[model samples]
Target: MAQPAARTGPGPRRAQDIFAATFALLTELGYDGLTVEGVAARSGVNKTTIYRWWPSKDALLGAALIDSRLFELTVPDTGTLRDDLHALLDQMRKLLTGEEAGAVVAAVLSAATHRAELAEVTRSFFLDRLGRELPLFERARRRGEIRAGLDPKTVIDLLAGALWVRVLLRGEAAPAGFVRETVDLVLRGVAA
Candidate 1:
């Protein structure tokens, strides 16, 4: 494959093309099948440039996932832990059960099983995503909705696990009110 010369200077568009190509190929080819050369060719960015920006396949995919912001969650401050979690989980329900991004995530996660590269990137992606919700917990603590020491990570894991199981594993939509009930249960645990 003929490599396009690396773009010269100051090109966010270059990064955008690269990330878009990464996702496209990620969806088309499983992680084990995705290649920098493929992304470079698809994006019209040079493979060397992609490598310069990201040292390895995992790094490239991780950068693409984070930079794409495809899985971003909006954490709402509803002034109560239950409401906030309900809102958050509702968003998750949409993403996990929705068609587009959900398919991409499922592809990557399925590929992660056999590919260490995919696993590393997927792990970082999930952790960073979960970390982004920290302020929700922070605000709840300030409002006395939960204790300061309450572990948000566990709560996040549990809530996400519920949706992932229903949507990813069982291929079922989360029943109506499931999000709110899950939130209430988790909030109740931290309430005392």
Candidate 2:
């Protein structure tokens, strides 16, 4: 007797459905309450299907974050460091303040603290984002837009840290014109 053909994995449509389900669950259940079974049920997919693509909830959530454009941190190249900084910072500010994103962001941040593996994944995600932006700083330095001795890592830490504390810890909306002010302050410290 001939054996059945091997099973192929999810295609693009199925992946989108899975991601949509993941986001919906994140918004409804929050991170702690979310599970693979829940996503499978919501997506009308099987648990094995999700498992084939993502090994764990953390992995699933990370992929959903990327796929849904929730982690959309594209570094801008506007020909000037100030302009680029404003663009990037404003993107971050909008992400943090957007109503649709608040629950998901809060869930992810809370999960990072409660789950060690998730925390590591979150750390890696942030490091990768920072790495992607390093070239922006490098370009600015090469063009004499910023000081020669500037460090990308330090700059990112200062900027990201301030935002993290303002939104997460203090639970305060970043003040009006916060993104512009942040860019100007950081530029003043680093401009050539």
Candidate 3:
């Protein structure tokens, strides 16, 4: 009999599908209701495969958040701090404005509130992902685009918070020029 092939993780498309299913289920069922079986059925991945890839629901959700569009944000280097911030915020705006995303975000937050493991995973996941943007801030500093004493985390919080309020809190997409104007206002305060 032939031996089984060495198994690696799901490919990008498979992973995306799994992650998307995870969020859709999360939106529908909330965190406690999400399970690897449901993920397998929804994503068309085997239940054993999902369990093999991620040991627990927390772990699976962690990976899903890492891979999903709503959480897996990338920082853009637009050669200028202004453009970079605008681009980043625009990406966030799109996510925040997504119909299912807001519900999923709220569900995640609600679930995180009740689950310590989930809260830690959520915290670390955001920190780890958001930390990637530090490089963009460092680049801005090198180029004398922002003040020497500027705090990247604070700036990010300010910008992201504005968008979150507009979308999640106010339940509205960002009005025209919101990203640009927000970036302009933030850069004015932090500009070199």
Per-residue lDDT of model 3, residues 1-192, tens digit only: 999999788888888898888888888887878988999999999999888888888888888777676665778988998888888888888776767777777787778988988898788777885688898899999998888889999999999899888888787769649999998998889988
Q: Which number leads on lDDT?
A: 3
Minimum summed lDDT over a 10-residue window in model 2 is located at: 63-72
Tens-place lDDT per residue, model 1, 1-192, is 999998553266777788888878878887766899999999998898788878887888788777675666787888877787888899888877777678778887888899887798888988888788889888878878777678889999998898899889998879748888887777778883
Q: Each model's TM-score, in the order given?
A: 0.85, 0.86, 0.87
Off by over 4 Å in 3: 1-7, 69-74
**Tens digit per residue, CA lDDT, model 2, 73-158:** 77999998888877887788778877767667787888788888888767777777887888888888889887777788887787
Superposition TM-score, candidate 2 onto the true structure = 0.86
Clashing residue pair totals per candidate (backbone < 3 A): 0, 0, 0
**Candidate 1 minimal-lDDT segment of 10 residues:** 7-16
**Alpha-carbon RMSD, each predicted model:** 5.2, 3.4, 3.0
Worst ten-residue run, lDDT, model 3? 65-74
* Model 2 lDDT on a 0 to 1 scale: 0.80
